[model samples]
Target: MTRKVPLANYLFTRLRQLGVGAVHGVPGDYTLRALDYLQPAGLRWIGSCNELNAGYAADGYARVKGISALFTTYGVGELSAINAVMGSYAEFSPVVHIVGTAPRNAYTSRAMVHHSLGDGNLRIFADMYAKVTAAQANLIDVKTAPETIDQTLEQCMVQSRPVYIELPSDMVAAQVPEVRLSVPLNVSPPKNTDEAEDHVVSAVLSRIYASKKPYILVDGLVAPDGIVDEVSEFARITGFPTFALTFGGGIIRGDLENFHGVHAGKFGTLDFTSYTDTADLALLFGPLLSDTNTLGWSTVPKKEITISLRRTAIELGPSSHNLHIKSFMQKLITRLDSSRLSARKPTPSLSSPRDLIKNLPEIDPSAAIDQDTFYLRISSFFRAGDIVICANGTPLVGGRDFVLPVGARLINSSIFLSVGHMLPAAQGIALVQCELAESGHTPGRTIFFEGDGSFQASAQELSTIIRYRLDVTIFIINNEGYAYERHIHGMDEEYNDVAPWRYLEAPSFFGAPTNGSYKIELHDVKTWGELDKVIKNAGFQDGKGLKMVNVRMGRDDVSTNFKAALQLAGRQLMADAK
Candidate 1:
């Protein structure tokens, strides 16, 4: 007496079971029928402007809500979204990319479909996706479809990476077993051997006891690996000073006494790297040491002094042990003796981001806003629990200097470095926030800091935001063109120039109403005083509806870190050319 369900029902229901509340995608002929099952499966369908934007939105949703789903038609749609999925893969976002592909007959007969290449092959896209995704499920057989979907989603959750599922149109309505839906997915990491765990624990504890000056370095992977709470507790329990990499800015609680500011390597103010270099024991959690994140790799501590914790392994100096991060953290926290550990005072030279910003020379209120003081001054406008999304380029550099309020999260492309991410991603994040708030969770504002060039890449998604009426505040850093590019190789090159739009008119052009029914406020700022006033306004802070602020700055003005990094890049390019 096995119950039967439509294949689409089983797929979408499994997604819902894994905590996916909404699905993001662009509709196409192949997926038109499959999209209908979303609502029946208790999932909200978000129609984004394009497949790429939909992928970005899904990535953002996954980062916040733990898991997200996206749909796209075969060939063209899937190809367009591959870049975003690759970005998700690079940054460890668990995104289930469900593709409505050509019917089974087309694949079997090798027939050409409208969306596919005129050639007979329909497997090319799925084959391409297999390179970037953790797993692939081509549901050609109805009998194995249920298990295939279950395992695909399980891989996504377990690896915290993207997975591809190619569902042929003909198979959407095919009957499948519903019995498999009752079994929950097992995403927990396999347990480590008792002896291995004990050995690693002993090594770590020995370092803690022997070291005179031990420090902790937090990174972005802590969030994906589900160890932020454990890391926070470990930091509190131990009196060691904690520092976050650029990607790890919001990972650590800013209010902790021993929580130092972001470690910017050589690009940071003098004295920041001194304490890190001199530390005898560095407990590095979830270390994603991209050159940009580590300030050209200048900030990564010496391997001899580092004990790196990863998702499935622990690296102690030159040696490594295969132990689950969660298990190791749990055992280490329980076994750690704070009373026996060394008591080291906070480093005098390493100051908090707030204190650093306060010490900067005050800019004239009437002067044009510059990158140096912009993000730091805007820090005053943030409150606890705010979610700030910083786009790549100037905003990424400046945002790292922001002194995030307690409980705030900074979402940025720290390693992926995608430019047009923050806008549509903000839409997805805001949507998830509203969905969760309905369930008694405290809602937070969705603040997006985007560059003008980056905004244009995915600007069409503004309509989706307006249609949903999400509380999203967008601040476009209008530096006229690609400022980051200008510093690297094209100082005044025509390729770096972006056409200037009447940036403030976005809301009206995107179908926003003039009447006060929906709060759509648009403002532009050039001077520091104007930016200050906009940040202090009641309507801006109310978090009612869509608000856009266009901030105009010079193309040459960039964060000190970015400028220095660009100079190094230019020199390297020159050396290569020679």
Candidate 2:
């Protein structure tokens, strides 16, 4: 142990122990000291062009690494990153946010504070995120720093959401507090064999058994929680068709007989919607059911047995209920007496609507797969612990709905919901994975799927990818426009149109070393025949270089089969209006 360690060192060490191998962000006033210390502590400091992108980079890293961190200066930094932090909240990807501020005493004085952004500048990020974070602090109460940090990590790692911990500039040099790093990371989900686990399991199981139409739905609990296999076991035990309401993927695989598909918003599957809500017993495991994913709230089962692995304190009412997700899953698996499971309605053949859209003069392959199938296919690409970096626009369709392979992540502006988050997020995630790879830890990959509109936002990250020499496979869905915007505004031209860029030239323009930098490959497909080659390419798994595939489709076509979706939403809104 080195002597005279700074307060920042303690925070960094704490994070290092929690499996955070990298930190993402552009160093600012508050975070400069810690950023410097990070280099010496064997941490990779990844940079993005802006703080928002920095936060997004960190969020993506968190998705794959199980836990991730970002450091920035005060106010401006914190505010910019808020969207990404919230995105992580929406996806339930656990990430640690460290923002630098002045010493608590510095703000205590009444001297108009020369250093802040216009108006109230004292507490800064603390107030903005106190409600959403697991814990937060600065250096003033140096003694409590350790406790605060520990609790914050515990909360973030266990709950699998974004948490904020503000560190003052002076705190970076403060003395270390009393906290042992070798506490043996016991992150096992809530353990209970008897009343706790068994009771909850029996309740859910009995309900499912009684109701002719019961379904299993899960969310963020799968990743950052190390319980995907266990959840799969539980699903196998009960023969109820499963579908997730809040999607960060991995609740169920399309190949799996149990998984029906994720249904949400204007992009949800009408078939799945018709089958699931009609049930009497609806099990919501490790899910929030956020507003964006209302999933026809007016139509959801009147009764729901909600299960959360770390729902110690939640706000709920009479119509809904809760359960400790881990214990509930464990007990459910234990109680099953053989009798493997089966799907409710033989998961009908997955016929794509690509034909209808393709028949039109122009339809992008990237937008070819409906939200559900797109998510299903993307989920097929990775497993637990692999990072799935999502770009804005079309890519998030896969992020929000894809059934992740437990521990697989959904990285973007978690809640911030910004569009250009993908590449920057992947940069941070890859840097960490590269470090971990060097340390001989787990062999994992960082994959990013960029949208035409969103890719342009952080296209510079291709250079960053080559600068650090990371083996990140980026799949740029060259749809050449902002597809989602069209749906939102009644499919108008202006909302969906954008200046088309040579998607494959990004790496070449950035001077990726001839041999060192991965080659940026382009694929402009006009027909399904051409798309097959893009999807079947062996290069995706190797992840050797910056391979950019320009997928071209018919532009005159409006293949998005949102008719049923719009109809349902209209009906539901009308119902709620009454």
Candidate 3:
């Protein structure tokens, strides 16, 4: 039972105990051993194109599992990951980062390292994380390495924040002392007593009770920790409208009254923003109101009160709790009504699937694409058990606003906001859930709403899917350009206009198509007759192989989305001026 700690083995053990599903990064001289160590023990070692993409992929994984891993080489690798780590920290996802370091012997004696910062040089990247992560450990002593792993993981798990562990390649093989690695010891969340809880509670209830148009702000953490029901009932008891910041809180449940919708902020459905801006009081259940959640501080209602509980966080490590509204809603929410709230049936404007197709333009073979019109068609096809995975650019803007069903997860890289997020994310969720389905553990469908700009970045993993042969569908919104740039910066006579490719042909390139029926089809259904046939074909044939459908979107019809985003931004800015 006395296994001398190989640095990789110890770190791997620590990651698994902390619930890290996968460690993603392109390996370099510094990270080879850690990457090899992580895989054999059941944790996935996913190799992404660049370090930045790996960071985003880890963030995507954390979105579902609530914990993830970022493995990278030293210096540049660690630096690349900081933006992503900061993003997750802001949103409260637990991400474990293992940065490869100089091999113990060579690095120890070297006084001046090339990538080292000033002062004859030391690793400055570890210090950079001090503001964001709950803990950062730079271990030099082999004897104390075991304690290093325990302390760092403890902070990551309990606080639901990120933790960085720096490992010198020198230490990877260094014979270290043995230590016990087990499930984390029990720890209590910071508790509030009667006096502390009562005052905040009374203030919250009084605000919620008195306001005729009161509401609940359900952030990402509320539902994952199993608090959705209590907050859902709170909305019912007070008959308040509810919303989600980055989405989680039952905004899409459809059972609550006047469910105004999730706080899409600058990136959400247009109507929802108006409701959030005007609400008299906001009982923000457990949201951090991170930068991504706010869309670069694009908008916030000044009149409303914002409250967050112990579990529902308002402040992060070293961050301030900024709010004008009630900060005491969490204590009061537990005691509210639990009965099923009055329901509002969604009257779909695109009433029927036929109606949706009728409104949608036919997918063109030669014509360029855009994210807007494709979202219209894709939204129309969504089913009960299907979850949508949106990429950062056109795919997210094109699709995240679409109404999803209850129990249908909407996975996106909203926090990290990086490209290539959709492919790896869809791969991770699809692989996990497919395994679950095979074992009869769960039943659901996952569809990745990805774009060409993203897909091309990480499309090398296409073989992994066919080799595993998972049940999932990837809807490639092929505009052929970086579509987000197209939206923000117009394509008027600019090189933003990219050449088109036969994307459906990609599966063949991977060489491991599903059942050898790897399909490559361009979707072009101008009318219901063509569209229905296309959908029916995809529905029956998705699991048969790697199905790539080239959805020719509304590239030229950017007016609607352009206006949708800018108009909202403009009106809101004017309101803020007021």
Give me the overall lDDT of model 3: 0.60
Instruction: Write down the TM-score of every candidate.
Output: 0.97, 0.81, 0.78
Q: Write the per-residue lDDT of candidate 2 for residues 1-578, one digit (tens) a residue.
A: 53456777877888888888778777776677778788666676877667788777787777767889977777777888787787777677787988887766768763344446546557655787876665565556766777777777887887877888888778777887424555645555554446544555565555555555566666654555566677666666564666655444534554466665555534553345555545556665555544444433532444444333434421122422344455555556777654433234544532222222223344354444333344444444566666666665556554554545545555543234567767777787777777777888774677777777888876776777877777777766665577655544435567667787776666767777776335555565545445555657777556655555565544422224443444455566668779
| Alpha-carbon shift of residue 521 in model 1 (angstroms) | 1.2
Evaluate residue 390 in candidate 2 and report its C-alpha lDDT on the 0 to 100 scale: 63
* Stretches of model 1 off by over 4 angstroms after superposition: 269-271, 360-363
Could you list the CA RMSD of all candidates, in the order they appear?
Answer: 1.5, 5.2, 5.8
Instruction: Indicate the worst ten consecutive residues by lDDT in candidate 2.
Output: 350-359
Best by lDDT: 1
Candidate 2 contains a number of clashing pairs equal to 21
Better of 2 and 3 by TM-score: 2
Q: Please state the error at residue 177 of candidate 2 in Å.
A: 5.2
Sorting all predicted structures by TM-score, with the top scorer first, yields 1, 2, 3
lDDT of each: 0.87, 0.62, 0.60
Residues 212-246, candidate 1: write the lDDT tens digits: 98899998899898899999989988868898887
